[model samples]
Target: MNARAEAFTRCGSAITTNALTKTFHGHTVLQPTHLEIASGEILVLLGPSGCGKTTLLRLIAGLEQPDGPNMIRFDGEDVSALPIEKRNVGMVFQSYALFPNMTVAENVGYGLKVKGIRRKQRESETKRLLALVGLEDYADRRITTVSGGQRQRTALARALAIKPRVLLLDEPLAALDAVLRERLRVEIGLLLREFGITAVYVTHDQAEAMAIGDRIAVMQRGRIEQIGAPKAIYHRPANDFVADFVGTMNRLEGRVSDGILAVDAEHTQARLRVGGGDRSAVVCFRPEVARLTAGPGAIRARVIATTFFGATQRLVAEVAPGRQLQLDLASSLHFAPGQIVAFDADPQAIIEFEKDA
Candidate 1:
């Protein structure tokens, strides 16, 4: 297909929810959420267990009902009260959910069969889907005999069988091993792009979310903390929770005063010349922003610990008597565990957030 044709062929439907809220047994499982998932975008809901990421997905899939006021709209029509079967949505579960007695082709063709596609058409579509997932050779293999990756592909093909407008993947990669999960995450992402389906993928794995999502929503305690592109979510988190949860972060709590941020009483500490006023605030800096060098604008620190990765090293240092900070550096630095080092950072790299600011 030509570029435009290929792009046009890969487009799917859009989904949105307004002030979606859910509660269970007097506990709020999903805080009111308003989100717009663009057509053909892969949106990953990421958070720890009990954070309601799955609950939100269930609401969108019409598997869970909204409490009140909240609404789910598909392509501008209200679908909050729609039934699961009538939602035109495909779902892939963590358990693969394939029938043990059915062959791979049978599993892939089951939906088409139920939809009343002719026998010959079902066979042709099954063959095409099997080939699309690179499982054509395993078309007749029983579910029990296929590998986990193959099973995942089978589940995906089966979900795609009915050609639903929206696809919901509920921790689908959780069943695979780490290596296979990584591999399939990429494969599934590619397949979603190829099929042009709008997808809502739920996962707690940060790496998986980063790898597969075009946009990610970081959730906590039934509420979404931030939503943005992967890089924005990682490098420019919305708040302290998002900053600390998405990646390794060092928190310096203090009060911002007179356009400067100070951590402790003795003004001889690493204070940030900020643009905000005096208020209870927290300063955040990623390890990558801290340089292991001695310069005019530097903080003298004592290395407390060092953990080395293949190509990089993470150092935890004491900048003040009781103040600690962390740094990530190249392995070539050759710094010892107990060595005294000077850390420098550009003033602009510092992010200051008032306690209520």
Candidate 2:
């Protein structure tokens, strides 16, 4: 258990949303949805802007009331009528929201001080939190003097100082540069897990979501399209939107007759033995599944371009005019524009969606 866990007498609380929903201007922004977050689990809501992810988080934080009463619960206790303060939930946002006049230690202990915590107790708790976030050395530093990453850490420490039942973060790293955002995301995930806090994180970055979330909930246009572990959500998307949103997916269209699907274009040569009967087929696969081969293979494409990644290169291949597929291969290999290449897709990796899909 964390040292602070003993002080709070509890670490996390299970969150349950029973048909939770939201609306704005007579139109529903968040569709009726049910969600469950396990105690001590980190759940990330991921999607593009205006996807209702933040709306969902606010509802749980008591910042927004759901469409119905008793729709949100914490550890099986109804907190619908409770205000944000009464709910005992801590929030961190992109702006950091620290006081410029106050020192790091004073800002962190501000909440405790407001709640009438004695000076000795508040200072001791603040000291421990600063240590947890690696900001103990900067305790006396003014908030305005710290770097972006340091400021973010101070905000996190401030939120945790209250010993709230649940932690809510809204794009907390969005204000940082790409490199700092990447580094602090891992550090933040480790800190939350070490403290064993049930946390709800909101972000549009897939890599961040994958690294921090125990489970990712992909939302689209006010509804959750898919919810599962990071691997499952990426590998087995519930629909086309989910597949495209999560990662780069190569789609091939062909005709299937007697279990064999052959691409119709004359420039393309792809024949895969599949399960469907005679009909048009749409198959999808990831870029990393393609293997370059010199011998005859199921796929033949004209290499349009190649981008050298550190360990692997991503090649854009045209199986048909204006239809390009991305293939990830070893970085050592070289390909020229308009060069014809043959590669085979892993049989198990190919996925056939419905006809209307």
Candidate 3:
């Protein structure tokens, strides 16, 4: 790594927000959010587009000022009062936002230029950053002439040029195609780790969050529903809302009696650890957990539809009229539609949540 990059790594900054809140037009967009991000760790704020994920990211970047009793701290010092440029934070936007008139190198060196750095120093630093992002030879190329991926790389170079203590990414891959998004996601993860700069990534894509985050914070209504490793968040969600939001889930909603849940009038009852709430409960199981096998506690489901997805088959089965359960099976098995198969899930695979619990 270049000396400029090395300097950013050595800072080893930390970010914390105490009751961070954002409101617009008398409506609270983000509720008070209390979060702590460790030094050099990659924290991803994930949710749908309108769920305040971007608002939270902007608040941290100082792009959106916070509202009362709220604070943003970096390296144990309050930074809420600082302007965006004064925060010394690297931010890569979803829109690459490269100046059309400037060459790749000029855009990369723009931040340094604005800081009044010497011309030779800016040139050397820009070269190092371009090489870092694998765009060294394209330095003189016009921004309009490069591919979307290259333009995104140029945006990264510009952000890093400032030697920011903390890096902020705002849906940086939303513009790329599927292949480029996948490829750059991995590459960005590598670069963040290599540079050892603390990064806060905002995105609604669960796969991206799972792929790049050291720890993920699932945001909803401007509040964090859960925060943990990707696998933990997937396998064990904090609530029904999170389970449904994070991945594909087969939800069976019904009433529970004596720690057992009845899927329907067909008398299929499964062991459930129901606590608190006399109304109804939602039993969630991943499609992959449901097996087409005849055994004790197996419920018969008629396969109504099937779709092939390369390595797996998605089988949609009906437990009752308009009540369906999805099963994920290996591609090796080609079950025909209208076939009745005994569908059962391992006890450990089932997660039950009460409607009012």
Candidate 1 lDDT by residue in tens digits, 1-357: 334225335446788888889988899999889999988889999999988999999999989899884389988889888899898788999898999999999999999998899999999988988988899999989989999999999999898888787899999999888999888888888887777678999999988899889999999999999999999998888888888778778777776678666666232466555556667777788888887554444455778888898788899887666677888889888877667776665567776665664
Q: Write the per-residue lDDT of candidate 3 for residues 226-315, one digit (tens) a residue.
A: 999998889899987788788988887777665556666343443344344455778888899877665555667778999999899999
State the displacement of the C-alpha of residue 35, model 2, in Å, after optimal TM-score superposition: 0.3
From the highest lDDT down, the ranking of the candidates is: 2, 3, 1
Model 2: residues >4 Å from true position, as ranges? 1-9, 273-279, 294-297
**Residue 78, candidate 3: C-alpha displacement in angstroms:** 0.6
Worst 10 residues of 1 by lDDT: 1-10
Worst 10 residues of 2 by lDDT: 2-11
* Candidate 3 Cα outliers beyond 4 Å, as residue runs: 1-6, 255-260, 265-280
Q: Candidate 2, residue 141: CA error in Å?
A: 1.0
lDDT of each: 0.83, 0.88, 0.85
Cα displacement (angstroms), candidate 3, residue 219, comes to: 1.3
C-alpha RMSD values across all candidates: 2.9, 1.7, 2.7
Error of 3 at 120 (Å): 1.5
Q: Give the TM-score of each candidate.
A: 0.90, 0.95, 0.92
